[model samples]
Target chain A: MNKRVGKQTIETPSKPRIIATASIVGPKEGEGPLKDYFDIILEDDLNGKDTYEKAESSMMYTAVNEVIKKANFKEENIDYLLAGDLLNQLTSACFAAKDMDIPFIGLFGACSTMTESLAMGSLMIDGGYANHVIAATSSHFSSAERQFRFPLEYGSQRPPTAQWTVTGSGAMLLGREGNFPYISYVTMGKVKDYGVNDVNNMGEAMAPAAVDTIAQHLRDTGRTPDYYDIIATGDLGKVGKRITKELLLEHGFELKDNYIDCGDEIFEHERQKTNSGGSGCGCSAVVDCGYIYKNMLNGKFKRVLLVSTGALLSSTSCFQGLNIPGIAHAVAVEI
Target chain B: MNKRVGKQTIETPSKPRIIATASIVGPKEGEGPLKDYFDIILEDDLNGKDTYEKAESSMMYTAVNEVIKKANFKEENIDYLLAGDLLNQLTSACFAAKDMDIPFIGLFGACSTMTESLAMGSLMIDGGYANHVIAATSSHFSSAERQFRFPLEYGSQRPPTAQWTVTGSGAMLLGREGNFPYISYVTMGKVKDYGVNDVNNMGEAMAPAAVDTIAQHLRDTGRTPDYYDIIATGDLGKVGKRITKELLLEHGFELKDNYIDCGDEIFEHERQKTNSGGSGCGCSAVVDCGYIYKNMLNGKFKRVLLVSTGALLSSTSCFQGLNIPGIAHAVAVEI
Candidate 1:
């Protein structure tokens, strides 16, 4: 019954199913290609909230509640709620959880939080620690902009390498029994830094970590790239996606057309005026929970590998002239 | 085999042992009551680092290395490194993990991180996800002061209700086998907000959460206050500790002299001029890793409950007029 595989990947023989999923997005994301897949779309980014932080929390709360409702389960049915966000101190996730009565564990993996929570939730179900668990995360463009870079009011000019932060939230409920796509393996990532210090270039900072985890997962499971219908990375936008493909090829893994980056898929780059692509915890979260999950149910994808990447940097760390450290966690789902 | 008890408590029947522990503290903490119990005490808080943030990361790195050394295990032997801190984006943990090759999972429970990490680590071992895992956390007074409150150079006067942020790091290694105290159960806490808005009074903000988790653990396990040799609340200080006692009493649980707060135990209140007491992620972490773990091995205590409380607030949230939300996670250790 030992679930650990090789060095870092964990095999979930019990195959905890993704019983329910919900995604909520702002107006901009609602106009994206995956618009029809989302559960809720806000007319305004603030959603009548006073601040962007509160809006982010509201989005996450809606996603969590919607997911539970979708599963036909009350709040009390959930044994544990594992959540995180990009905000400092995880304000969004914590505030969202405050309204719920479930036991909570807050996580911080930057953008990788989507997979981090999913992996932990799966482990809880596979390990017999709980029957139902909710894994969730959120990110808001205005909130992240003010915290990490320039405020939206400042109207700072973005470089070509800069990516748009998605204003959205995603929640997935994992249960002991379901006929949906189930989590079969999880590859925990290591902190990987390649001395990338440009705050504007998150893609470059996070690419190596994505490649590292993806390669590790394939190696640990002894599976070829063809084993998965699609290999998706969390938020490594255009620049990082290209780097990830090259680096993965160097690792003897050919990431062909089957490979995609959530950041790259989240928005219409040119039409949306997103320089690189959509980037944030929400980018991958909404993509996976909406498009990916729905497609799997429709028999489009039999197997999928989700590698959520995160750049572990803060304004303080950047001010201190430290390089950004990146991390990526992978969760394998199969029908 | 379900392991989950009544509502929130998850029993670890496999009993993952605390095989190794190490604590490193700043000069101020080295002068405290449990100074002799720590593995390493620094003469300077900065430890030759340019910034206090780096100092915190270095201390945590030292603690992780020391614990691994104490356990006679190589870096590869440890399956996972679960760590967090009070810093934004968990910079200290990420930088520390950057040096080590272990798979990392970043967590953010504010000060409750120690027990949060411990709970997750215990679950990992109990669930057969990994053979070994490390739970660690750190905080630095200078770094936290500037980030959460005023800059140290501001020489801002602290009120009696304000607790001192501890400058230290603590790491513990949990494994499948050992002749030491093992984690028996973990009671996950819910985010509880009581409309306490004072930024300086963390104890008052976190007290209700501490009480809730403690009472829930007792109710779920069908245990009385006397079931534990000592019940410790992490960094609740004097004000919060008193509130916790009163609240628990209202819940029909009378915590007698067996109750202790890590915040109160760390520093000599009057002598150290730490108005309320030491309060930070390091407060409970260093105490448990240095004093409690060592004492347990020496048969000085039989069963202990470590409840680490956290006030989830940031400068942004506080500025936005949001109330501080508190959370507490408990891990029961028995010899």
Candidate 2:
């Protein structure tokens, strides 16, 4: 187990560790054309419309398959599967986990699910429960829009801080440490509510939470930005990332070289009109399962910090003028 | 880890395990009332006009507090939390988990989340990852009703198969071993679509999934109904339970002395009101947490099978002409 740096030490299992991770999404929404496991499927009758469940499930299905293939295993070898998505019942993640035929466990943490899954899965491996564990998450715009915001056809003006729903999914595999890089550390994002009432622009509303989590990780680890090659937040696009940078400077620390955000990275190519950035579990997941995995495998970047974030507020709470509480988790991996 | 009937196969990390579980709904909306937890915060004039999110936040806040207190746990000692509720992005669960200041991993399994959480948490203990993991789930009538079917005040006519939501929350602790019983074996429920076209009543929609999972569990373990004191399902309600019983008999098994369904259990007080039975993750959860936990601690029942079921289709999917797929998970606990 890794030693503590600051107030409390974070320990990962010596037994069970995540060995591989993967993800997939629609062709048009994907970062690249061929960087997907299965062919991108879009139904004709539903123009530019996809259910959060479908978008989430299809990608999750692909991710699970990728992790399985990477490990060179069949369906039954996996003892259990843990998954969740941006649905009321975690249908996409759970349903996909079920079909995959692994003993399945489901979870939901809104956009922060991927990190949470990693934490649980990592702990499992550390504790020596099993040799392998899989975690995944996904989301879609069509499903979330109607359920959380408005009807599918409703054309409401989005607030500048409002983030576009990420249309994607990501998956990972954990096993005994051997050849692959291991998750050295994980810190959960503290729930910070600046009491900002306007969720139309989530980046501004969530910036403080992201900042707090990063700051805490730094304080807890007693490490500066030089400790890793890059620090990537789950979502938080340009505006949010800028605010985070500004906040970091205010605290007497700076991360100028590569303090990037995952949502901004994933949506860089498939720019769906949005003021701030993309937000969802898929933001980090897609990037992790896709770009991040490829890069790490290709020996592009070593020692990276992936801090996924989530906004904890529902439609009812939003309607009641409750402030959005944001949380993030930092996962450190070294090549 | 505990060994099953036939294999005599041993687990790597030896300890108690989480097995056969159940979740079922009663009349109250999402989950049933807990004896120790405060009475459901009835929506009155002050909160009556609250939005789905508002009522949900309030109820969730109250329920979580009660769950923590009842579990006799100080928030800090909780190594990790597994929680999920029915809402877009799991806003309610996230908000609560954040405020609790307990590092948590949120999850979503729709109504089957209770079982899913149990399965994952149990695996953690069985695999030697944790000594304590709390699995919790909740649902609210206003929240679910508004999101899927109608507004809280819609007062629409009820369908025959529409199971009542049991406005409640259920939580339990998974550990290496306890004075009370421990989760014995966890059998995952598969995503089975029986092609049932009925949507108005969830019993019709989810019955097949429950049956399939329970059948698979028995088949996989090679155990018979005579092995357990009870064979309970999460929230199939009266209608769904009846169908499940019929299916089980058709499979040449009879749970003669000790087979009671959770949905049917909660409604024993007000049979007429419960009508068919409970439906929702909280349905089975509340029963398990409020009723079953106490009984097991008191040594009323020894061996039991808890199978929580879920229908993985959403209102939009139904409208989109997609069939509702369902899943169930069974965890057995022995005192």
Candidate 3:
């Protein structure tokens, strides 16, 4: 009955089903490789809103509505909506939830919010606290750049290590009475800081945390890399992916063969000019909901370990010369 | 098996206990009426930190560690740490959790974080997800003022309606094995916006939301105001408390005698010069942990309803001229 498996993993006994999922991306992402997998593609990042922040909120609202439509359920059917975004105070998610009229719990895990919400939603359903829960997150390129980096009008040049923030949103509905792929396990993560302070290279900053969670998951669950058909990490771009693989190998878990970073899969690096890769709350969100979830439905993957990584550094903390702490949450899904 | 009551409340069949708690307050709060109740009263708000942000982080760290110590448990004994603060990106909570090495889940409910964390932690325990969970939140007057209002050096004058943000942190350790006050039910709230846009008068903006959740909780549980010995609203302050009481009376529930606002209990309004009383993430946190929890332990109150209200408007949203939305989550506790 003790669902906690070693240090940081929770073994889900009920295996709460992921009933439906939907992803919405901006025009840039629509032109990317996995464009067809997305449910809605915006021709403009603004999405008819005046500010990029409102545009991000619109994307979240759209994704939540689309996922509910896909599940053929009414808004009243959702018992709780757990959501978060990269914006300060989670403006996008909170604004979106305000219109939904559902019970809301705002979360903040930076880019890892997608998986954090999913893990919490699964537990809510599995624990019989709710019949259905919607977990959603969003990020916007312009909004994030303005908030975390520089002003949009500044047109400042970025270094090659900088990862482009993805403009998109993803929502997943979890329910107890579904025959869809179910979340089998969830591994929570501790804050791990490797003393990296460069805000520009978030991929490198988050890499070690992903490594820690990945190794911890395998060790706690007593599973090898081969046990999972695919192990996907959130937003650890090309640079971080290499570091993650090395660290996992150092930790004695050879995770290279079956592992893939969501950021690396989002765009064609050479042509898209997404220097390192896509990075944000939305980077891994759209990939997981559009690519991985769809593939699982098609029987392309039997088991998957989706670890969403986050850099827990605020602009204030960066300004104060604090080290960037990173965290990664892993959820095991089986069809 | 259905834990959900009429509409919004979750009736926990397996009640979760508040095993131990600790509160740390700044110099100002230490001079307040509830001074004797707080565990740690700092001689100065800075507490040897250069920045007020780091000072808030130190307060959070001290409260979390003190709560663990009070419970006679090490950091490893805690399965998860759920924390938040008024700082952007939850800098206080994240920085505190980084040093603890516990699995962290950062939440953002603005000022409602105290009850939000308590609700989530209780569900985690009752659901058999974890045996022990720590819920903590903090807010510093200087840090919150700089982020949400004027900078410390600005020395801007505030309106009479403006409330002072409390400088303090509170942590509660929830477990399944303790004989502490049990969490009996939780009511997750829906965002309610009455089109109030003034960031300066957050109490007025959040009042309707506290009314909505309190009424929904009473309706769903089929209980009257007198069903509990006390009903405490988080940080509605004097302005919000008055509005909330009127709104609840309009909804056919006259909650005048037994209801109290935590914001009203902290500082003496006239003597402390906190115009509209205390209002922040820390306002209700220290009040609940230090005063209410201590009183409950002494058998002063058998049953209570704690509703923590929040105004979910970021500085960005306010700058963008968006209306403020409010939410209030309620928890039923019984000794």
Candidate 4:
């Protein structure tokens, strides 16, 4: 039975295993530092699709198929597909689910969707509700830019605080038991808003949420930062990562050298000209499913904590001058 | 233990109970047939908020607070808040969560979100991950119109098949044990597309998915349609409800007089001047939480199957000339 550990954390005694994983990225992300980690790197962002939205859906579909294939499981073997993406009404996930033919549970947590799906999937497995489930998410640079920011054709100059949206998709298959790394605990997060209104500075907006969830996770699990080999925050970039470190310090928890941000690690920031670094639903997804999963299997990391952060704002909300509220969900995985 | 009954259904033996429910509606909905069943009815749709989006968020916030209050539980006593709405990036749900201070899991199934949240919340309670959870959803006609269709200011011509978006909010509090109606089973849905491209005719688009889930649920649980006192679909409006009846007949499961559509029951069609009927996330939400919950408590309904249907389409996808896909999640409740 799954145990409610503390205020926010749930301890999954059954330890749902990550049976298989796959990641696919666009041309720009392929040129980044984690290039060798991804399973497939597209030559172009559009991938022969007429629209960027279709391209995003195609990438997610490919990743789902790849993960199932890696697990040697037929499509019917999967019990559920929990997926979300940074799209209006989750268009990409819905389109991908249409092709997959699995029982679908649609989610929307902005960029935090990866860990959100992971936490829910783990709960379903640990509770004996399902034997196999897939968690997946995707985001496209061009599609996000047009929806959230200026259109690419306008050549709008972005501020230094702006982060580049990652064009990629990642899929992870979880099972009741396996030799692979297992999900041990999950920490659900509350929305945290520090009244940050700048749309370009999502890092600043989401940092408080990252700090809240991470600190709450540590407190609930009764573990220090040193307990894990690595504590990774999803897509906080340089600016948000620094803010998280400072805020977490104020919360009486000091994140040391073991801490990392997927946004900061995914790209060669200065060389790649990714101003603040990579950010999107795809940022943490690709990094965790590709680089982190591979390293965990290789025995390079025994235990890891992944906190995927999301800035809950829309173009409409931003235009209405509403404050951007941030949220983060943390999942602990161990080998 | 939760048992996977068949392909899509899960038998929740623990039977998570609906401890309390609250429904709030706008002026138009307040004038509807089920108006007296709602907890609160606003004189105006805006509810004094400047923007329609904020008004929608405010309604959801009120519904959450009202539900908790009705249950005699404090905000902190609620373990999780699962919510979604019809907006870009789920603006209403995020903003509502920001004010609630509870662990939030954002979901997006378009109008089907009410049942989706309920299914997830019930699973959480039955799975031992949470003791008490709130499942909620909201939709405002003006906000949805501006987001999905033309703005109200445009005075766009509507087809006879077009359904009027409902302006309301509903919230249900689910606990591990209680004397109230309990969720006995849940059937997760898959995306179903019949190549329906007409944006105005959403009812026809979603009927196939509704029929698919209802039939699958009955087959998985080894029950006939007569097992439920009432089997309700979320927002199939007039057009979709007829289509659903015909399709289910073809599937060898005849939906008799016990079948109802929340959208169809919401308003007095021709008198209300609602083209097809009322529709939105709030349509099924208010009907179920208000009319259905109250009736169940009064021994009017011993069993109910709510299959919330959603058209998984965005304005972007519609503009791209893509076909609209549909999904429906069914939660069986019994006293």
Tell me how each candidate scores on DockQ against the true complex: 0.88, 0.31, 0.84, 0.81
lDDT of 2 by residue, A197-303 (tens): 76666666677877776777788777788888878888887777888899889887798877888767655433456556677887788777666666776788777
* TM-score list, all predictions: 0.99, 0.84, 0.99, 0.99
> How far off is residue A185 in model 2, in Å?
2.9
Q: Model 1 Cα displacement at B203 (Å)? A: 0.7
Q: Quote model 1's TM-score.
A: 0.99
Model 3, B136-229: lDDT tens digits are 9999999999998887898988888889999999999999886889999999898989999987788889999899899999899999999998
lDDT per residue for candidate 1 within B2-89, as digits (tens), equals 8889989999998999999999999999999999889999999998999999999999999999999999999999999999999999
Candidate 2 vs candidate 4, DockQ winner = 4
In candidate 4, what are the lDDT values of residues A141-258, reduced to their tens digit? 9999999998889999888889999999999999976699999999999999999999899999999999999999999999999999999999889999999999999999999989
Model 1, chain A: how large is the TM-score?
A: 0.99
Best by DockQ: 1
DockQ of 3: 0.84
Order the candidate numbers by lDDT, best to worst: 1, 4, 3, 2
Once superposed on the true structure, which residue ranges of model 1 sit more than 4 Å away at CA?
none
Q: Where is model 4 more than 4 Å wrong at Cα?
A: none
Which is the better candidate, 3 or 4, if ranked by lDDT? 4
Report the TM-score of candidate 1, chain B only: 0.99
